[model samples]
Target: MSTNTPTPGGPSLPQERRLVTAIPGPKSQELQARKTAAVASGVGTTLPVYITAAGGGVLVDVDGNSLIDLGSGIAVTTVGNSAPRVVQAVQDQVAAFTHTCFMVTPYAGYVEVAEALNRLTPGDHEKRTALFNSGAEAVENAVKIARTHTKKTGVVVFDHAYHGRTNLTMAMTAKSMPYKSGFGPFASDVYRAPLSYPFRDDQLDGATAAARAIDVIEKQVGADNLAALVIEPIQGEGGFIVPAAGFLPALQDWCTANNVVFIADEVQTGFARTGAMFAVDHDQVVPDIIVTAKGIAGGLPLSAVTGRTEMMDSAHVGGLGGTYGGNPLACAAALAVLETIEADGLVDRAAKIGSLMTSRLHALQERDSRLGDVRGRGAMIAVELVKAGTTEPDADLTKQVAAAAHQAGVVVLTCGTYGNVLRFLPPLSISDELLEDACNVLDDVFAATK
Candidate 1:
């Protein structure tokens, strides 16, 4: 008896969209002033604003300004804020009692979530799941699991990887200023290799690039000492860089040959965010382990490491877990997120978003020399800015465009190892109308900046 579609009666979409004042209006200004007074400036922010309410594709700022949320809480709210099913599930879990600690008193929510993760991640074989509170925890635990399973001490990362901010992951991450600077002396023995960035390294083919990376890893750390080769199918925070077509397959092959654990850190690119349940599916490369968080539990904090049961079990009894890991509320929210991703065809929607954004950014790049390269898979798209007539990065111009977009009632995030790429991670559920409006705003800002 329900006649709902993605248009109006859609159960998970915005009932209405409204924007009265400028973004981060009066109330946000006051709160932001207070935040600066209390919070550390070292923790930099891309948008100096506060959000109050959100649903579907719109974010309501504390100042009551309704801005189209292209960021999706940095890709955590793919099911969209206040999704009916998700909200209902969370309410139900809250009413049933929030937490009892899985280790102390194991519960159904935790087991069910582990079951869901096992069923959803790559590989049809048996899998085991371990939950955590954030992506950082998941990555650290994956490394721990990999090292335990392989009995190796060295872990290999790539040039533009952005794993997380924990000290160990800070060692895993490649950025210098915010994520890594002065955060060292970090955990030792993590090594970095060259990523297959074709736009920048046009001299090599995908297989050649993979070989180059292996050369560095084999030469610097030695395969005898390697534990895991972790990578993002499409790089997130660092920049939405999708490596060349065969890159993933080649790297995965190398991992198998070297007896190294292949870890796909899909925390930002998973759960239908990149047109697939997991971005690793694109290249038909099944990683030994897939680390996921972000969009997994709707908006709640939950992450998992699902992989070959043997590897996951390599850790001794009681070797992995946390106090708040897989909290009941978060597990309920995650169950809803999995259902929404399937029920709403958001995976296909991710492809649709990628099509729309790639076309628009490419057009902009054609028109503006500053918009140098447009790359990404599915909805995880980015436009790299450069000094016109050269590949030299233009981080300053990227900063300006982001600021102008925010002032013009749109919020866009900038990222890249060099901080010169404008990345877009809008909800897969965002409407075409709202999406285009955001695109038009970007056009205006780009024109002005030029």
Candidate 2:
């Protein structure tokens, strides 16, 4: 692992995982009780530790336990929680004025964010950007823009894709029990296609997978009626599934020929969470519309839809935007995030993090027959656990390992269509020593589970 120290600008933290009490200590238990009464049952939390402060790769809970943060709040705090630049910008902006409503009076911060996204996102083609409050909102707007531009109603998504949780986005998402259980009567014209899942797809190559998906799309939805093809360059909640090589490019080509707007949902993979600035950059496949959020604003709620200027301009002036589409404080945070990524060379840092994780995970895989696959890019990495000598998912064992890690003062997350994948998204600012320590804990957990 690289011997680099934590990034210089974040708040000073102990940089070590510490546990003064159990995983959910007394104070946290008290807070959990309060949450049970006040918060909705449907809003779930992976860990019930109530955090009071977070920075430099650790989350300090109300009970004074400093847990190693491997999830990065599900990839939102890529630059680390309470990054100095983001905190400073948000403070100054809040002092000046909280909200003027970009639709009403407008502000330079919003315009600057849009400008930065326009320059940063893929392709040299002219682009325009519109900001929103979340990944779901950005996706809804992307579909709206695609329909307006192409005059088509059908929208194509993948089998294991996870768009968001809004009504329209829920329809786009593939998981059923949680994301789409009782929520029914979904929006029409949304079609699902098979994804290029290499591990589960019988060693199918990129061309074959793309061809299979295209056959389904052409037969079911008809390209003439398709407005957009929305996909994550690196699938997130659906197990960090990276499409086979050449798969994304082929799909992009088909979309181009059919005049279907290809939208890349970079919410979880954007802003250096992956080794590249954006996941799509790995393949050099530029989408017509790119939706970004998650890590875009340090930790604030901000998302954007950036696309070709012609397609973006097709929407009517009053047709887009909401009350808090681009809140001034979020805009400020986003600007700071962009500057931090450039000034600190976080793109390279992400690559380093990925190397450390993949190397350790691969070594683990070599020792354990239950470890089926280790895949993903940069800071975003995952291990798929399976029954020994078979590809059958071992969800129960996955749960046991994660629980063990949590008890040992490490914060790990599990995700996948089959519920058997353990994902890690450590902050780019995290130190190699801390990451190595976390892996050591994981090593023990897996050994015990086996």
Candidate 3:
């Protein structure tokens, strides 16, 4: 419905949204049946559409539907799916060598990625980096390094935080239903503090919220025993809750005073996805350690924990690293991703995307009372759905709205601890026209649901 045209330099795929059949169509339904038989029930998909190809702002399903991509594969394809740079880098690296094990035989690509992360992450202090396979691995290793550096065992996390699904990260996470349901006997010495959820916290100021959380940490965990305080600059899975202005800086100050390492879990908010290279850049808060993944390697599975040189060096020789950690192919992809981000000015692009999304969503909110709160920054934005007359979360409405959007050929994702948040994470390379089209679809769906 949008008349705007695709911008130049995006992927070559047709930049449009089209639905030829019902939501899943017939082919996708058949594949869904096969998936049901072959895949475990534990693995669930947001949409049953079988995607055969994706590029620019569209996901081409097996059924021949060109669905506008707004999730970016959970914010992994910041440079866009199959980006030219990433594809070329991977192809060249694969031709040369797939894997020789970084632990056994080091490669220049790995070192290059580490050097890039060290130079890009917030703060100019001398830093070190350790590459891993995923965000969970990077987070676990960050904890290990923090403990080693501070000689303490306690780590403090925040409410509504979605760290990871690993044993250690599960303990660090706050949600229980899907992430930490059956798993039990989680790691010890982990603490949860309150976060600054402005909409739900009665509009508490950032400084007051920080004081309240710090009070709990000092009394319950004791700052003396705290080795690190880990938090997401803008939470990802627990809804895109951007903490108040002073919350992060105050927490960083507390960590510095207590000799506790401050860890920024920027896994879902890093690599120019949040307007800035990192979300901490928004508040000018420098974290002692920052964990990054998702958009780091342009869809490749590569994560890193970059931090102060001393903290990173505290770990003993070979205390970190795994068999496939920092695979050569992934490292090469990361290098190209970094280059693409810098050259294409994706940081500024993210800001423009944020402005477009926020302006559109805010306009919709003015008309729909059920749209509770519109929040987030850059390409990562979300709307909390609630009952029309009250603030009570309306998860059913959220589901209906998302289903309607998917049926109409828009790929949207729902998140948040309350299951009432609809999030949009479009690729930075998405055309303005395609983005407007997706929003138009969302507008219709929301109106119909109401």
Candidate 4:
């Protein structure tokens, strides 16, 4: 429909996958050595291939290996890396004074970005938006706003949820090995409840799952003490787990009845990544507050907390905002991203991408019982690995398959509480041919491993 396929590599890099050498060629290995010396140990890389250019569906690495980009930088470059409009906007904004600090001298870019968010997010009710630097910051601020509005302290998150790395979000997150390991004494009053994981929950229906979760909340943390119930409409880092139908609406209804703020953490699922503009659109569930990041500003570092006007305003003046919260460059990039999504009809593109991926993964699942489940919406899809003839997780196999894909010049990522899900967040800019090639590679990898 819309012809906005981004040429991030300036028309020089080919979109097709081309492997000049091994996966981590000599040049990339050299960069890795330098990175080991310069960067912190906590910072890790998945592919370890230093990217020199990326555009369309391929990432050109240092050794001229043009690998197919299936991860989209963990769903950050949904509009494609170095998208035309985003690049132009950032270039123009940087030249025209980068930062005046919104807290000091406000700029129109910040206001415009907020307006776009307020209008674009799920819900027609009067809303306001506050920008931040990362998903964790937005989530933390969402809690702050909810607490101020509801006058409550308790925050509820779902099992297998991955909020962020900040101390507060770490407590909210479910996994511990890497996200929360050694990060002790997490924030207080954060509670975890059950989620509607259909594959692992014995094919539990949505209503029953919601009831199960509601019982936990009511019995453990009473409604009166709860400030907000934060959830990812489609859980991200915890696996691309799509909750059973009616699950989200049920939670929203319960939150409404309890006077608790319903916050949708759309950090990894927003901006057309999940086919719909936002994942909540699937169920028509309107959250009291929605936290967005990832694809909001193409590839720039920007996050936002948008919600009802009253609740957003409840926070006292000077309560919100940071030094580099709504930097002009980020805001400008966000504006371009919003425009690109609208003008280029990316919502439909994401849906088509989802259909292609789902079909391919489902076909693979039929041949291999190890692919326990294939689920997700739009470009955000995943296949959970399990032992044959049983749903027991096979995290080891997941690592093998992902490593194999990486070595073959396909950038695949693994996730899940058990670390057995191979999640795919390919950029919509990817052509059907590239998508098919990636799927074929997976097929070969699975067969070879078997």
Which stretches of candidate 1 lie above 4 Å from their native place? 1-19
lDDT tens per residue, model 1, 378-450: 8888999999989999999999999988877676899998999998988876777777878888988999896
Which digits, one per residue and each the tens of the lDDT, describe model 4 over residues 1-450? 112334432333566777789889999999999999999989999989999898788899989998989999999999888888889999999999999899999999999999988888888899999999999999999999999999999999999999999999999999998999998999999999999999989889899999999999999999999999999999999999999999999999999999999999999999999889999999999999999998998888899999999999999999999999999999999999888888888899999999999999999999999999999999999999999989899999999999999988889999999999999999877888788888999999999996
Query: Can you write out model 2's per-residue Cα lDDT over 226-308, one digit (the tens) per residue?
Result: 99999999999999999999999999999999999999999999999889999999998999999999999988899999999
RMSD of 3: 1.0
Q: Order the numbered candidates by lDDT, best leading.
A: 2, 3, 4, 1
lDDT tens digits by residue: candidate 3, 1-450: 533355444567777787788989999999999999999999999999998998888899998999889999999999999999999999999999999999999999999999999999999999999999999999999999999999999999999999999999999999898999999999999999999999999999999999999999999999999999999999998989998889999999999999999999999999999899999999999999999999988888899999999999999999999999899999999999999999999999999999999999999999999999999999999999999968999999999999999999999999999999999999998988888888888889988886
Q: Model 1: which residue pairs collide?
A: none
Residue-pair clashes per candidate: 0, 0, 0, 0
Assess every candidate by TM-score.
0.96, 0.98, 0.99, 0.97
As for model 1, its CA RMSD to the true structure in angstroms is 2.8
In terms of lDDT, model 1 sits at: 0.87
Error of 2 at 65 (Å): 0.6
Q: Report lDDT per candidate.
A: 0.87, 0.93, 0.93, 0.92
* 351: Cα error in model 4, Å: 0.7
Q: After aligning candidate 4 to the native by TM-score, how far in Å is the CA of 283 from where it should be?
A: 0.4
